[model samples]
Target: MSNDEDWYQRYLDMQNEYDYENTTDASYVQSKPVQLCSKESLNNFGATIIPVFYYVNFLLSYLGNGLVLFIIYKYEELKSVTNIFLLNLVLSNILFASSLPFWATYHMSEWIFGLALCKIVSSAYFIGFYSSILFLTLMTFDRYLAVVHAVAAAKSRKRAYAIIASMVVWCISIIASIKELVLKNVSENQFSGLMCDESGYPDSTMARWRLVTYYQQFLLFFLLPLFMVMYCYISITIRILSTRMKEKCRAIKLIFVIIFTFFACWTPYNIVILLRAIQISNPGEGVSMCSEEESLDYALYMTRNIAYLYCCISPVFYTFVGKKFQSHFRRLMAKNIPCLKRHVSLNSQSTRTTSQKTPHSTYEY
Candidate 1:
């Protein structure tokens, strides 16, 4: 029995030694490093988190943006040069938010929708994103010209000019998004399922493409737009302070809030992508030591979700904050929604009846 136990222990030792030798062989050692940012992390973080965010933003944006669209469409009085910009802004947000479900599904499972939709959905997202910034910038500029050169703007800022500007903005947005239509497709890896991502090109080309697009979005969408908005608003603020236009307080406050919200959501997202672009440039080993790249992955993940939320809140800035829009919204809400109308009518009736029942109540009941 003792001799058998010693022999079994020696056999186990020999097996462990042989296994270690095989593991350290040239072929095994030379194998490419595993991509940490791929399936496992996405399955854990993205699939669990992104769909909820996508759906929440989708519902909020659809209702808010859709309400703005409805108000503009139903009421002729709601239409104006600034309101036209708001209309386009709401439209683009709705168009963008409509694609959220697909992205959510893409992250969770296969891109079962296919290649054509991948292109359309992907391109539409960018078109919506760029158009959003464009309209917001134009809105700021319109306000700037209106406040600074009121009489001149009144003469120049016609409905025709707004329509032409809307067309131009849409055209530019579409032009910028054409690359997504060409590049975005269903991913081929079985493990990743059918992902609708930019996987049609080689690694080198994809890296270059990502870098170019990152810089483009950073410069055009974020930085330049940020500078322009801040400049216009700061100039407007100075002008207002120098003059006696106290009624401009509400508008300026809303503008400040809008700019702050935009930056809060997008600045981190852009910074994360810029870090990713920088990491991509470093190739392999040297870049991996930045706290295991998980922090970068998580940041990119979280910031993207934050960015999508802006569409949901934009209508709050554009419509709900405006007195005209509120009155119109209230009227429209009272008119179309029977339950709301009934509630309001009942409340009014009860108030009138109570007034009539009171001693000093000769007021119309």
Candidate 2:
């Protein structure tokens, strides 16, 4: 056998024969030594990239979502069924961003916060992350019903219904995150030191659990919801074009913006993890090249930074693109940035009409 194949074979043999109970060092059989990121590389990569991204995301997400919450609280018009969903979306972002400081510190230093805090923070992060996606899905459905089946939607629409839906989404997300809440703890990484990493060894059972969760995340968070969003948006587009619902044009634009932003921020990260999942699922083998493994490690690090940046991006999108949001935000800014209020006119930006506009009309949502 060639040297490469022989080396790979031996690595696999070692992995299969490894006894975690006896071993002091938790070494997995990987073909590429570089795949196990070195301490200097990790410090340079993790400390610099992750903390910068996390802190930026945290600050912007907090400010943006906080502003949305304030707008909802201060304005009478922001209480519509659709806006209620938007309110919940902002809340999800805030909740998600709140977990960032812990993670930022975790990535930069050791897991000094102990096991219980690790579990709580991880649970909060998962709940916030998943719930944002769920609420977005709900918003799409609300739009679909409002535009495609206006009268029927109106008959069914209640402020109470939106509240109930928001509660259900949050409840489901929290329940789904319970496993992570239980599993997460402060553990020692050979390279990264005592950190809030997964405590499990890379054994068969953990591998299976990882596979299941990976599939669950891909389907629930990415594939299925993406398909649903596409269908809803497309149907809404067709109806709007046929009826020339010009006011609904902004709503359609918002949908496109949201879908594009979501995929842009999340697709590469999800794809990288999915590849890792496939590797994990069928891992009696080793990678062929050190550079290949290094590339993948870099890819994961970069893509995760991109995904985390989404929490920051979301609030900006709502603030800039959602005309109603812009109007209210300007009003808030005007109070402080006093000279800027001269040109502000919310009446023109208002989506409400004598008939309350289409249910899915801009900000009518």
Candidate 3:
């Protein structure tokens, strides 16, 4: 056999023989190398680093998503048309972020949790991630409708529709992710640590499914939303420049920023995944499959981390952008505040006295 075929054969054999075992469990296999052939290049680095990355991501994502939920819940005024989108975004992020711990543990040890959790939790990860993307896409469309087609949007921006759409998005996400249950089975690698990926090593079907998912996300979540957002922003910019409504202009700018942030963080991951799909389809034609997998895996992880930043930074946008949410927030704050209430009462009393002291002018007739 040629050297290339030999290398590929060795890689294939490595895949079949690799054992991932729980060090604590005596039953765990410890016959093969601790790492996969795919990750051979990173063999110099300790496996412990992976867990550390996961833990840090878990902490940041949990705190950020929690705070976003709090901000929306605490301030009633944030429940405007704009914030409806934000609320969905936060909910999706929170659920998605919760999966980090499970992944972190899975990386460190065997799938001791069992098949049910292995299937369900991993599926939940996809659901959360996909749902977030859908919600962001919805938000972009919502913004476009309000800014570009205001009159039509005013009539159609019903809370009922938003609720219905969110429900649909989630339902679809759950259904799409459910397939993971059937696809993933428990397996022990060379290290004897149980892992939960596709049963067959380097399964092309699994790669195709992953590629399809990425493509769907790109078309539905990124491209469509990007087009609409760009159109809306361009139109909004022209309108703002021609008009004198400073507050409205600022609101449009803020919405643009939010859209830009999503696009910036997620675009790299999407492009990389698509390219990965291409490389997978035409393998051994100069593309290093092992290196591609490692790079794509790292890129996916980093992209997810960057995307979570939006969850943390978005509260600031809500506070600063969208005059309506801010107005509502201020009114809610004013009402809840004792000092502001007292001050307002005193101001009202002074106003009454001044009115009583003043004489009516002939113009009153």
Estimate the TM-score of every prediction. 0.80, 0.80, 0.70
Q: Candidates' lDDT values, in order?
A: 0.78, 0.75, 0.64
| Candidate 3 lDDT | 0.64
**Which lDDT tens digits does candidate 1 get at residues 162-220?**
99999999999999898998888777786876778887689999989889888888888
The parts of candidate 1 lying over 4 Å away from their true place are 1-39, 77-79, 284-292, 336-365
Candidate number that wins on TM-score, 1 or 3: 1
Clashing pairs in 1: none
Worst window of 10 by summed lDDT in candidate 1: 356-365
lDDT of 3 by residue, 139-251 (tens): 75776576557778879888877878888889977886877777878888896478877676466678777777767767776677667666766666665555545244454
Shift in Å, residue 92, candidate 2 = 1.5
Ranking by TM-score: 2, 1, 3
Model 2: pairs clashing at backbone N, Cα or C within 3 Å:
82-365, 83-365
